[model samples]
Target chain A: MTAVSATPTATPQPRNAVIRSARDSLVVAKRNLIRMMRIPEVVIFGLVQPIMFVVLFSYVFGGSMKVGGTTDPGVYREFLMAGIFAQTVTFATAGAGAGIADDMHKGLVDRFRSLPMARGAVLTGRTLADLVQTTLTVIVLAIVALIVGWRVHEGIPKALGGFALLLLLGYAFSWIGALIGLTVRTPEAATSGGLIWLFPLTFISNAFVDSSQMTPWLRHLADWNPFSATVQACRQLFGNPGVSQSPAWPMQHPVWASLIWSIVIIVVFRTLAVRKYRHATS
Target chain B: MTGAIYAEGLVKTFGDVRALDGVDLDVPEGTVLGLLGPNGAGKTTAVRVLTTLLRPDSGKAVVAGVDVLRHPNEVRRLIGLSGQFAAVDEYLTGRENLQMVGQLYQMSGRDAKVRAGELLDQFNLADAADRPAKTYSGGMRRRLDLAAALVVRPPVMFMDEPTTGLDPRNRLGLWDVIQDLVAGGTTLLLTTQYLEEADRLAHDICVIDHGKVIARGTSDQLKARTGGERVEVVVHERERLTEATEVLRGFGKGETKVEDHMRQITVPVTGGAKLLAEVIRELDSRGIEIDDIGLRRPTLDDVFISLTGHVAELKEDAV
Candidate 1:
């Protein structure tokens, strides 16, 4: 048999590394976005939970719960929207983790690892795709919030800023989810592992109830939670009531605290998640 | 010159389990090297290391003239890998999957689309190209996976048990595709437990067991190493087993083996069919009626059993 010599074109020309990484990441992201579009039920289910929280909290305990000092239902509805929006974005961490874990289980990650693409592209692309889904979910939830007597007292620009911060926080938390996904054995484990900490993280923060009502130490812990910082930031940006009067630094400067916390989480967790991804065996 | 794909003294351990214990391999350009082994024999581990999916504990590997450990990304550009699992995205259409793979390989969008169409047609997946891969059968999915691996037509390819779970017809179909790839000058490293697959496709076979290479040669060489042709006879009467053995031993080159319950006698021999006819005549003249008699060459199964003291498949945890 005649030997086929390696052709000159067979060897890829050297390109800018950063540009290739970004391009590869976008390609992966496009694939995932297509998958999400095909599986509409996942997006629908993602939307249903946040919508339910909005409706249930607005009608059930709006008047009974006290925010600031009053028990007014209208006052509480405005206060509850920010918390629900933050919760909606943060809760998407489970889906991100489960999605990655499923990819690993099905060997798609192995397929990607064998390719010449950037090492972090798979994760960055996945998180970016998930961020899009979370954005859609937040949009629908905002409509639900509007129908339930929840209004953004601030101008449209500030409200958009609030939504931006919520997404940033969501994107940051996805790295944590990505790390959990890589660490766990199965998607089911990833789902559970992703949520087990989120419950405390969101609940202990100022997302739902007023932290001032709690005792001193628990209040302190709640005030310092990263989840609370974003929630507090959203409230201030949206010009919603229930702003914290706590002496804690983050409660006073919620927007800066939120930006710092999200950036820091992205740096630390993205580093860990990308490192874990490179050495992942299965 | 060294082979296009070469490795020396590769060692990888997963905790206490030594998945690969100093393995070596070399596959020249445009040739197929079959890494034949039972389950958990480190075939997957070796493929993973060569494909840059896993790092070996200690080893030297070069693919397409690039150092695997030091320049894995460069090696990745020159190789395609289809793993044990069909790693296509189930939610994506067949065309979408191929296009996605092409884009990942850095093909332009229009180029990826054109390549996807061509591959879908070549793999006989054109009809199902627009359908989600989840709707396809196992064989279709496997074909699509193979097509995905060929998105860029790299010079080197690694298929870990490419036909393990495929049905017979699909297995033949895949064998045809693989042969076409090799004929077009793609260097291939295929791993499988089926000796017949290795015999039909591999130019050279490496028999690995317990994370070590026990034998390496062409199909005929391994079979010849096991043993030559044997004359097996099953006598009609249980009482005549002794007579049959005595008759067979007269022409036998080795000790005659007798299975009393089956009334069968087997003896190794060097002569071809001529000796078999003479043995038959001798048995007939002695009034030793034979129920069955045939001269059979040792199959690769026999080679495996002889070399590893077990069959070519074992139920164990995968490496």
Candidate 2:
């Protein structure tokens, strides 16, 4: 084997540590994608679920609910389309978190700690891999949404912009999921916690129904939800006609609210996740 | 770069249990250090500290010239670790696993692939390179894991019970692989329950029990420390087992016992090979014809049982 270093001894690697760290993390993410690709069934499941959700909610549920006194109306699809997009992306975040828990259980992440890689790479790589996955899922779900009469009212650039927003929104959720995976000892708990957050946050928000038409308390909660901020952002970006005109702080521009919420959630949850990781390993 | 690795007064408390009790280690370059310990013996805790996986709250450690506590990332770059478990992802093909590791060390795509293929062939996983690692047998998984650790060729390597589940044939095969690595100028710190492994692989062995190194010396030195010649007498009849045991009892004053499972009588004799011949002659005179009579030095097992009151515990706590 040819040694890369020409010197008699290898020395300390002090300069460009972060660049090397990020490069290493990119390798980790690519490996994850390869692993995910190996289980074609899992990839198929991840792809199919969002489309099924779009059909179930937009067609089946859309016919039953009346908005503006018109049952069997098409406006509900437009109203809930962006919200559904957000929900689909949210569902994909569990992959990042569950992957971490599996790696931990298998002792892979612990092995990385003994190597010259960045401490955050394990979590960061999972998040980055999920960003790509969530993007792919978004593109596929978008096609399915189009099949179900869900059209983007915005121009091509704005629609592209909307796609990027949904992905960032997914990445934020992925960070939370990564923490969940790192903190939770078992895969079962990691999965259940993801579900516990998903069902309520997705359902209780305006993703399924109009928040204004719900009970005063439920409406207030949904109005303030992070998912709602995301959905509101999606509505503006997609140029959807039924976009709510809520002027809640950081909500007027759904884009900024979603971005801020994603950043805040990433910071708070990652700090907790890193702490849990340090605790469990030591 | 002075001592290859230094761990001083390493202390770790897991809630109420003190896993490591102020353990201290100093290892020089270009040598293999065998850490022999029973289950929960804190050998792993020390490895975790020196490898920068876990922080030692009260102690300072340096690995390959870098302080592990203050500069973990630098220490990380200089060390390679193959853990107790084969931690490679099952879904990845063996080749992909190696490639991923190479890339993790910042090797370019072409360089990483070349290194990955070389390791695949070196570890004899080339034929199975494209197959997912889940399909590899236990021995193959272990070999691939070791190969992955060598992707960047770090100066220091830590193997924690690397051959616990491997069969005898595969275990020997892995021993050869480790020997080659160490012979090629890699400094290794390996922990194992197999006394034969330490005897074969480690130049100097550290016998640790209850979170402390009770003894550290060369294989011969350790065996001589627990000085005694061991006799294994294989006889024809099962009842003769007891007869050989009784006769051998007369030869050694320390301890004499029947190894019913292997059909041999074992006794600790201060007398060397000359006494072995005398014992055989006495058994023959007493009409106890033997199939085989073998005399050997005490193993690390004996030194451990003498010092710690326990056998090696590599299997019990394996991940």
Candidate 3:
């Protein structure tokens, strides 16, 4: 009785697409936002961990790292901000993908499936909400940093630009989280699977240091890392642009590259996550 | 409203497991059709397919004249579903649980709030409406879950063993609520393992085994298929049991089971009460004084056993 049909192409509509897509997105986003608000512990702790990471690294290692030609511990906060922002986005987004795996474990998504609501809303709403939460985490950490005497050298407009750039970059980071959550067996597994990437990706990039301080190959890898590029752009917005800060090196428009990387990551991981979610339920 | 639920050859598969092989179901408006099956027999799968949670591999289903496959949104607007477990967020209060569900159905702010209170009151959860569901009793939670499903007041409802874990009293309470809904001309498709539940609730019972429907008929029709009513004869004295068993075997050409320990002999009664009278007379002639003699009608249990060769109690890991 099973008739197998080829997969349908998910073509995005062009005209009046903003309104249509926004409605679709809100339908997905509202359920997740309500659920996240209902469970305050997850939201609070999820936001807290990133703040702790930022403060801990800034005080403990910031004083020692020679960054942007300064040995002062205060200067490292600028570098740490970019890295911490990226890390927080990863941390917050890890749940978006895993929500499905968790719901499957708890049979919640299975129940949701019985309803006639859009199936995609479960994943779509969750990822977007996580993106919003990640954005909030960035804002919170920014406040804490500002109070601790950290300031972005760039003007007000650049800081806003940096924030916008980082938001899109964070949106991209969550796509990977979505993929992990959908592909893993349990919420624990999804979480561990998702968080595992952050450790290696964050550590290898120039999130907390000048790439030149590391070995030549590690520096090269960090310089080319898309994760690092995102942090570089954030540093630029925060008046801490990496290449420009180093007087000997000619600066580059890494923001455009960061956006490209974000788009690529978003498209590829979203495709994989949706496919995995549909197949998991099917 | 002619056919609240209509499915033809509905099929759903999960990897190698055929949750639903090929099942067809039809229930006219305002009728209850019990989808009875043991665990893993795909009863929940059928419910899922009908509810549009899982698309059928190949089939056509329409609820309230809307093709479920084509216009699932419209179908969603017309029906409510209560899965095996309570889907209410334990974090939300009982009132909020209903309110959220009402909102999902697009009920307005004031309407959803009022409906939530009314449902809490109807389900006997008015006092606990402010408290989180995690603090509720098992019966209260089940009632709230059932209440959440009714918040939309959909014309058709799908209940997946709504009374399975409830105590007898709670089960009766839910049964009363269901009866009230059915009386109000609501169509229902219920999946259950309880023989008595299906017997008491469903106007038509479908006995499903191995992911396929094996039997479908009214409680009486299925009972009638078990041949005829059973004649149970009990002997006062232990020694009269042997003679009574033989005497009962002689009354009619029907299967007889003799329990020497209990001093009882039971056999199918082909000629009804007259046959029962003949058995008593034969025992009387044999000087076998009988303590009791009576005819017992076939029950849903008997029907299940006669058809599936398995009692309903073996509901382990089902669903």
Q: lDDT tens string, model 1, B1-319? A: 6788899999999989899999999888888999999999999999999999889999899888888999998777777899899999999999999988888887778888999999999999999999999999999999999998988888889999999888999999999999999998889999998999999999999999878989999999999998899999999999888878888999999988999998988999989999999999999999998889999999889999999999988877779
lDDT value for candidate 1? 0.89
Q: Estimate each model's TM-score.
A: 0.97, 0.89, 0.86
Candidate 1 reference-contact recovery: 0.53
lDDT of 3 by residue, B52-109 (tens): 7777889889886778889776677677788788776676689877776665555554
Who is ahead in TM-score, 1 or 3? 1
Residue B208's lDDT in candidate 3: 90
Prediction RMSDs, each to the true structure = 1.9, 3.7, 5.8
Please compute DockQ, using alpha carbons, for every candidate against the native two-chain complex: 0.53, 0.44, 0.20
Clash-forming residue pairs, model 1: none
Considering the two chains of model 2, state its CAPRI-style docking category: acceptable
lDDT tens readout by residue for model 2, A1-282: 121131132233443868876877788888888877877776688888777777777778887786545565477787778887888888766777778888888988876766566667777788888888888877787887787777777788988877777787888888888888877856777878776879889888867776667887887788788898888777777776556555566457677878888888888877777677665561
Model 2 stretches with alpha carbons more than 4 Å out: A1-18, A245-247, A271-282, B230-271, B283-296, B314-319
Clashing pairs in 3: A28-A125, A63-A73, A97-A178, A97-A181, A98-A181, A113-B53, A114-B53, A154-A239, B39-B318
Over 4 Å off in model 3, which ranges? A1-38, A116-119, A213-221, A241-251, A271-282, B233-237, B250-253, B261-263, B270-295, B313-319
Q: What is the lDDT of residue A187 in candidate 3?
A: 83
Instruction: Give the winner by DockQ: 2 or 3.
Output: 2
